[model samples]
Target chain A: MNYTSIECASSTSEQFVPMSPAKTLKVYWLETKFEWLKTIRNPAFALPAILFPVIFYLFFGVLMNHGNVQAASYLLSTYGTFGVMGPALFSFGAALAVERGKGWLDIKEASPMPASAQIISRLIVSMIFSLLIIISLGIIGVFFGGVELSVFQGALLSVILVFGGLPFCLLGLALGMMLKAESAPAIVNVIYLPMAFLSGLWIPITMLPNFLQTFANFLPPYHLSQLALKVMQQDVGDSVFTHLLALTLFAVIFFVFALVAHKRKQN
Target chain B: MQQVNSVKHSDASQVVASIQGLNKSFSNKQALCDVELQIKSNQVLAILGSNGAGKTTLINTLLGRLKIDSGEISIFSSQPGSLAVKQQTGAMLQVASLPETLKIREHIQLFQSYYPNPMDYQKVIAYAGLESLQERFSKKLSGGEKQRLLFALSICGNPKLLFLDEPSVGMDLSARQSLWKAIRDLKNQGTAIVLTTHYLEEADSLADEIVLLKQGAIIQRGTNEQIKACVSSTTIRFTTPSYPIDFNSVAYLISHDVSGKYTAIQTNELNQTLISLLTKYPELEDLSVSRAGLEEAFLELNKDQLAQSKTGKSVINKGEAA
Candidate 1:
């Protein structure tokens, strides 16, 4: 109950001013940096996104398969894409759902920062996770898989999967916006794990039942895996452009769904 | 003659924010009914109400989180959600939270990036009393500590207009004093603040203007003195000596309850009534006087509303308060 307005008045003499509103680029960069720290530090994103793919590769490609270089190289692309998908989906879908549920999203809505900064920040974090997954898998491929590939091919595949992570992120975002926080992880898992298996990240599509193999062509991961395989000169069932087009279409569809869900929430 | 219009008394040169005939509803039950408010720079306006009194709704409406069904709101001459307004405004919402893993300093820094002209971290920490907890993770802090960190984030933007919904609800007495001090400094710096609290004494000490809300309506709005003046009656309670004192014979007595051993009297004339009471019953023991405090005024205004609310379920359309 101290009414010391006089002391505060004297203390308020400093010409303290807020800086100009942050530019869009600065907002994106800062948001990414903090968001990256958040994503990397969270056991939810880090343990599964980085460790799962690396562990899987060690088991199936190294110890189980006895270091078959060609098989190892082929599995690397699919598993890298698989690793990338987990973070992209969970970060946007599950993390966003929880943030929204916790009322953090409402706080940002009142902030001066650009709305798209949230979306872009999540994307950047997911891509960073994708890079980590690819690199971790690459190191594992070299040391354990006895895989040998040119630097250009490895970098190209990494870039491909990194970009390929987006569609799953969009899918996660749509799920996040539509579902409750408690339901998000369950829903993302239902979509993520099944999609990874159906799209042949665990096994080649040709080895599956004919109908399942045919169905794999429709899934974005299948296209992503196909493109990565094509980069390694593996015999993909479809043309490179077909896989690219399929992935692009998936991105567009999921992106639209996420956009619509966001708009709906705003209203 | 007294000038009765609250809006007429507001300084024309210093309107920091205004709401014109704001009306909002959820489904059929109207949550806000034709609410009008004008806030001036450097003034602290407390929105006082009990639970479910639309305090959070008004805050959310001003912050542009909930769309008002009707009426226009302007902050610094711009729309509530517009960039011009948002840049000049900061809010610590009732149910808002921070990222748990981030350290206190990290939380401040993140919110700092949102504003064009944010105060330095040193000023923010000093004012918010967050210096000691700077390195602590947000998840590890006590509820009061978390609230202080949120306050720091709100002020770090150097906002010209600030909205705090029950800012010190969970804080200890010392922490509460620190928060009030920070708020006072911000006010001294010419920040316009809108405060909502159930603590009547908080409103009594800090508010330049108080809006008493009931059932989504502005039942009373004015300065501290003006509000107190609205309820002119005072009460005198005393234990009687079982003597039949004709309380009605006392002039200025509005009403009196005379029982076997007690008498309670209400009147507008305090000094005259006290003199008359002493002359009539010098033996009157345990005498005490009570003025119509803000809590009484609030209860008086919302007596019917409370009765109606308790009889049945209040429509729960405004679920955002959770």
Candidate 2:
């Protein structure tokens, strides 16, 4: 057909070059941040996660006070860790699973966006939501809750607690991508309530059964709570180092599985 | 933007995608077997198959969303799922389930930023017929509206290649027609399209080339005319009140569609068969003849697979592997 002859003499003729991997990832991150912003502005998506933490802080940290000042102060730290866990599990995890079920992940895959950006965006969004929860709870703990922690202590508590809670974030990410949406809320509840109770969110670990205390000591929530408590109390106990190591280990394992699961789903 | 110009303006005809000896197994079930295909630039290749015929699997392989047990697939001369190649492709998967809280316009804007130089925001909204629905939350949109929104997202990037996996599933007739028009326009703009649809008529109408898949394998690949010729012949339909006529009497007969007081004989010799049928069944009335369509060819292509499943030679079509 002599197809080349049509544009043979044209100086504008060019080859179809594709975008680089790094550029594609950059686009994905930008779009994802934009999505996070839109999600933030809607209030519908943001309200439940944000409100849940604030309400809990008001109720447990301020209203009830748990009778004992030290216990109330302890609850403040525990609840800060507990507060952000909601969005990490309910919002990010449930959303990931449901989106996968509905084939949205597949849609993104087909786009020119980088695959890593997809997961990275979700992680960043969840982390940001978690950070907000921590800061809000810390504020109530210092001001309204009548807790004696200083601004420096409260800020340090929030920072440690944010990263301390990463394992839970990765755990939620894995669970959300693995399970079905119908079972997501139920499954999240199953994970959430027991972990919170066992890890002493509702009760002090010292009051729990010896078996539960031992088991709770191994969980990520326990580590996060311990880290938050140490910073808020200005007491760096020997347990703090163990909790950090354990939480880091849990995050490493979880992150590996989540990446593997994502790759498996892709192919 | 400078990079965008350098990339998009390049020649795109040089075998942009190639699939060779692909094999995929999910646990115990083989979803794709020795599948081979190639897609060039500026061609709308329509993949036609019944539900669960590995259409999605093929797409997953091409996008490198699923790993194939044994196969080679490359996109734009690079490996499949390569960032360079994937970044140049836009896609509309089966159904979009974007966050319900995000408005349609927001969704469009978010996806647009993923490309260096996407189409204008107003143009995309207009293209997807979402001008009226742009303010509505994604959750509030009707099925057709959601489909349109998804379509709008798919083309906003001005991608060189587009993958539409059942893009018009929930669309209305007008929406479907408009989508087809949009698809044609994209093709005219030199975009390569790979689409899968349950609508055989849509395939016939829009596909420059058709690939029929069955049981994770390519059953037929050619233009509509060439594939239809696989079961080429005309169907002779007639009704008689006096007696029932057996189709065996006619030579060159392929099959029959029999109902109460009516029979349709599919034959290679349309002229001779019609004459024989009229003379033999003198009481015949309301006779009609028509060419075999993609539907008939599709049925013929899958008939053996269906029979094999029934006889327990193959797994049930709907059975999930453990």
Candidate 3:
């Protein structure tokens, strides 16, 4: 509408300066911060994510076990695995699918936000949820179930369970890219509940039938729960390297699936 | 001559982005065909077409969301999706939402972090008219308010080039007016803008140039006045008189329609047609003569395309309508 003003304004803002390292870091930081804030504020997601495993453990590990330390400690490892999987799976899988369907993902992609920031932010949130779940379960196990553990063993178990959620995160990422928004929650639940049961996260592999016990080897959550059990010396006597290798293999497979889905979406 | 002079004056530096012979297809359906476009600084180019006319497809290709099959797309002399191009570009796409939990100010703050040199916080809020609603969560906002928030995010970077696709779709009149004012301010700030809208009046008021697309091909390209001039015929409407006059003798008459009490005549030669009608009936009441607006011109152009298709004719002679 105004020609002179346009000519004047165009002259001043033409350069495309590169971002500084500090500014780039700030972008990642702020992205993660906002992502964390959004997730925590949603009661539907945060409430179930933090409370489910804690409640399940309090019921099965304490009230039913009647102060049996060995059962409490073993259930702690399994329930911790169960706890971490919820956040890692739903955050990456369901949230991502909704974002994609809403065109929110497209908006972010069109901006200068680094794609890695998105993935990294969700990973951090999942781990934070895992930490909260493990701590709550830990408090219940110590005070109610009388499970005994040195500080070192407790810390190692926490570290294993928190980091072991990586494979599930990758699996969720792959599903998120593939699933539609309206059906994402339903589909994710279908996959999650069965996988958790099959992996012996709800009950120990030894308690299952021979055929089902053998099937646990193929599920990523089984390997993660087994790794957590190793800290309590209650694992099925496999070397630590075996479980780690299995989780790594699953992560690699899921990562490839995620990559293929992402590439397919771009075209 | 004026277009040529404007082109020569702007030179290569003013051309922010260019698409040459672009072609894209989805399976058996072609989404774009041999498209060529140039986005110049300080200008608004409106792409107008009906649904499935490839407007969104073209915008997606420019945003690098869809890959073109054959063509050259250079934005800031780099590839479309490159960080360098994205840094200098902003877009307000047709989206269903922002993250529902985040407040407006939080969304703005997060988006601002994406760009290296972001606009000031207060300035972006003022430009998008989000001052009063800054504290509200995104999910609580109405459709128009959400559109405003999306607009704010798009301009958070103070981008040199902006792509707005149906930006005013759900906006109220006052909100739409403010959006237009903000667009004008951005244009004055030298932002090269590409707008696609169904509202012809919106395009007419904001666009320095308009591209009419049909069935994935550009049918016409010109300024508002130039495009309107393509229709040529003006309409003359008057109340029917008691005496029936022979209208066939009217010079340069395109058509005449008598509906109820009103007689409307369309002709290319406005002066001769009015004179002939007035001479026949000295007491012509409620007479009005008006040229075709952009909406009429657009429909006329599309009607011509339909006629051309039925007759097995081709009108792909680019820039001829101008």
TM-score of each: 0.84, 0.86, 0.90
lDDT of 3 by residue, B71-135 (tens): 99878777888888898889999999778999999999999999988999999999899999999
Write down the C-alpha DockQ for each prediction.
Answer: 0.29, 0.32, 0.42
- Report how large a share of the reference interface contacts model 1 reproduces: 0.42
lDDT, candidate 1, equals 0.79
Instruction: Name model 2 segments beyond 4 Å from true.
Output: A1-34, A37-48, A65-67, A142-144, A232-236, B1-14, B239-254, B260-262, B280-283, B305-322
Q: Which consecutive 10 residues in model 1 chain A have the weakest lDDT in total?
A: A1-10
In TM-score terms, candidate 2 sits at: 0.86
> Per-residue alpha-carbon lDDT of model 1 for B206-248, expressed as tens digits?
9999988888888777788877766677989998766678876
lDDT of 3 by residue, A99-133 (tens): 99999998899999999999999999899999999
* Candidates ranked by TM-score: 3, 2, 1
Best by TM-score: 3
Per-residue error for B170 in candidate 2, Å, reads: 1.7
lDDT of 1 by residue, A53-137 (tens): 9999889877888757888988898898899889988899988998888777877888877888898999988888889889999
lDDT (0-100) at residue A217 of candidate 3?
Answer: 94
Error of 1 at B70 (Å): 2.5
